[model samples]
Target: MSDPSEMSNVRILGDFRGDPSPSTLRLALAQVLPSDAESRPSAPDQSTAGKEDDSDGAELAMQKLRLYAQTAASQGADVICFPEYFLTGAMHSSWKAVRERQEPVAAHPNPEEDESHWLAQVAAIARESDIDIVAGTVVELGAHHIPHRKDAQHKTGGPGSASKESSDSAVASKTGLRLRTKDSSDLLFNTAYYITRKGEIAAKYTKRNLWHPERSVLSPGHPSSHPSPRLFNIETRRGLRLKASMLICWDLAMPEAFRELLQPSDSRDGPLDGPDVVFVPTCWYATDAGVKGLRWNRAGEAAVLDSLSMARALETESIIAMCNIAGPNWPNGGDAHSFQINDNTKDEDLPIVGVGHSSVHAPFLGCVGKVEDGNEALLLAEIDTKLLADARDTYRVRYDLADAV
Candidate 1:
């Protein structure tokens, strides 16, 4: 799967990690199916027993993560990214339930010393594999980082902004997870962590746009709280420097999210105007297309994913790396009814099927590499910065929007 032209630049010093290319980043998208035992809701257990089960589940998930990270590294990946909520699985539990089962981010005093903590374990795996990792997301409890702002507009701007008042109290109230004020000492968050090759916590991004279903369990990140951009920079094994950012599922549907990352900011410190690559970790399902009676058909959401990723790539003039959870059936023609979850259900069950189309997109090239089916697979691609430069030169998207942003 190596790009011959890009591979030619490799010095072939020895192993994959040693043969670095200054301009090409070997990106690996790990499309993994979470352990069903971990993702599924367990029967109510006694407090002591539940704690043991939770510990076991975390260990099991970490085993898979370490294995995959190693596998990706062996295959010459400078960076490997997983899907959203891949660590904790899409529990879809209530806030109270989540707070009870998961450790608060504040509670972890020393992630390095606490091997039981997911972040600590993932960080270790990054160091072991000697690869940078965008470790999907984990559901956790944490204090509100942004204080409540009454005049905060409650709205985000961009071409893909959700116009239907997604953050409106009335809408959020439907899930019963809405806070009276944005500030709270205790709250659940769907947080994504970025770990460097040395296992440093380079950056962390809490998802800003909550999927309708997620609103019931997690809080969205503050739109305007932090003046600086949520971004990080990485130098690959080949010395290809990349500026990147992370977004969770549903955020991809909002073009405004992309704009917020791509738009140049005088207050920012990263390279270029913004991120050269955007990593999206998602748990999106095939049944999450539209409201009942509104969807074109059962398979319509597949088109939504493909269209949105492409649109984001073309419009932003950058690389979009998307990795989604993989699951059994449906996208492979398994009956939708035979599988379980639906959007409107209150059961909060793990999705038995996913629209796993893990892919990488360049500005003009569209999808450079993709996993066509919803199955466990590692999608690798040679991301050449030259293509990004060429796309910007031809489109002049940056030039036109220079003054607008």
Candidate 2:
């Protein structure tokens, strides 16, 4: 059993002028991946392969998510977040395979229409568990028809150039666009959905920054002509409102995305308090030998992930909950050490990865609660709304930025 004293403290904020007591939100990070063995159909089912296999994989993934969510809820987690692409597993080895497995967003801008959809099932679990859920990223087929590469390799050169094949033929052949005029379309996006405690869809954020290989199959959320807001506002059951922002895996590597969410807006109507929490769902890969030298002798990928999360949290003065996928089947599988950053701590002070470390960070306190790597587990932490507010009040980073702007 865990000791009660080790649990993070939740302080109440605001004056006691008949205001409701401060609510402590128990946030849970689910760091587990879908089992590849379970996803595979039995030997008897191999006769009808392809589509059946994809559907089976989707179903299995959802089951895993629901089970974990129930566990978190039972442990009294108010909000739970899974890793990026937890719904569909990692990217496949082929673009064609990816396109074939992509699921269409039910009735665009109106996901509630289909109650039996995978995403709806996710919401149902949240509602049943009485917890808000950041259900991770799913491959959403959009309404546009864009040309994509036939192979899954990342492009090394400029646009229209292929690293493994001839430029002219590869570009011309792969760029062939089969126009789709139907209202329901076939464009693909890496999308994450936020489900309220009531099991209602709150917001959906598409990946704006695509990793090199992902560019071959997925489209960016904000194209040149169309724009959308990545940040969202979430209100807890006790009326503790938090300005929340979502960022997919590779998006964290780009500082601009965080800046946009953290920086005060030009309009007077913009949030005066700025974002309180940033949720990052990632499937970051392990660094290769070449990159290890630049990152020092520490755990390459894990170090980078921890550093980025901490840096972002300190710079923005907000709590960061970063959940990552873990399993032996993953590429560089054990390297997926998820971390939360609230401040700087000695590298040696952190625990080494047994499976992968998942944690929650509080403003100025580095790690408030954490689960070391190895087994699948739920990391729960109590985030005090008042403490967060007090930190912002003292730092005044948001106020200073607003004034400077």
Best-fitting candidate, measured by lDDT? 1
Per-residue lDDT over 1-405 for candidate 2, one digit per residue giving the tens place of the 0 to 100 score:
112332222111111223235566567787766433343332212322333345666677677677767766656666889887677656442223545655555444555556767777887887887789999887766664333343233234777656544543354345322222345355667788889889888777878777765655566665331244546778876777787888887777787787777655667743344567888887653332122332454356666677777777766778888877664422334233333322453332232232344566667778766555534556677767677777777776677767766
Model 1 C-alpha lDDT per residue in residues 123-214, reported as the tens digit of each score = 88888889999998877777745534542345456788666456555445653344445556467777787889898887778877787766
State residue 305's C-alpha deviation in candidate 1, in Å. Answer: 1.2
- Cα error, candidate 2, residue 298 (Å): 6.1
* After superposition, candidate 2 runs with Cα above 4 Å error: 1-21, 35-52, 93-98, 101-109, 145-186, 223-227, 263-273, 287-298, 329-355
RMSD of 1: 8.2
Off by over 4 Å in 1: 1-20, 35-52, 94-96, 101-103, 145-171, 174-177, 180-183, 223-228, 265-272, 290-295, 331-351
Clashing pairs in 1: 160-255
Estimate the overall C-alpha local distance difference test score of candidate 2: 0.61
Q: RMSD to native for every prediction? A: 8.2, 9.8
